[model samples]
Target: MIERFIELGQGYGDLYEMLEIMKTNQERIHNTFVFVSEKDGKKVASFAVAMKPVGDSKFMPIYICREGIPYNAEKTSQRYDLFKEGIEAANKILITLEVKHSSAYVETTLYYQYLIGLLRLYHYIPNLG
Candidate 1:
């Protein structure tokens, strides 16, 4: 399967769009995730919505709000609260993971590839056919 990350933006205001997407596609939703990383010593989180592949498409989109809220456990914010509530309302748990930042990679694509590998390793996405 081909999985990709669709970056929305840092969670300033675009988060609502991400949440609505999940709400509308609830049946297709498989995982809601928060990726926490320290950039410049500041704790930031990227929210993601992982969906099952569309019929025979093989392209599984992992929509994201890259690096905005603080790590969910350490601090609480209104935006993060909305995300948490959305997940709870969907009856799904949001999975939080600590990861290396994109700055570690020379190219942005590399960063996405790294995340894809991590997802596969965790069995969140299917392996290549």
Candidate 2:
């Protein structure tokens, strides 16, 4: 399967769009993930949803809010709460992982590749054929 990460910014206005994507495609939901990583000494998280491939298509789109949420700071914890509640409502298992920051890689593409590798290694996603 061809899987890709589609970024939705730091989960502000874009967060709503991501939620709508998940809510509307409830049946196609595959997994929800919370990737926690330290950015400039601050703990931040990136939220994502992996959707199953439709029909004969092999593209599995992973929608995400890339690392910039707060428990109580510039952004409120309510945003994260909304995400948690949404996942709970869908009854899908939520997978949380501690990972290195994207800055570790020379390019964002490399970072995504590392994540996909981790996902496959953990059996969260199908192994490469």
Q: Candidate 2: where is the Cα deviation over 4 Å? A: 71-76
The alpha-carbon deviation from the true structure for residue 93 of candidate 2, after best TM-score superposition, in angstroms, is: 2.0
Which clashing pairs does model 2 show?
Answer: none
Model 1: per-residue Cα lDDT over 20-114, one tens digit each? 98888888898988888888888888899999988888889999987767764756888889999989878888888899988889987899899
lDDT of 2: 0.85
Q: Considering every candidate listed, which one attains the maximal TM-score?
A: 1
Location of the lowest summed lDDT over 10 successive residues in candidate 2: 68-77
lDDT score of residue 40 within candidate 1: 83
- Candidate 1, after superposition: displacement of residue 65 in Å? 0.7
Number of the top candidate by lDDT?
A: 1
Given candidate 1, what's the lDDT at residue 33? 89
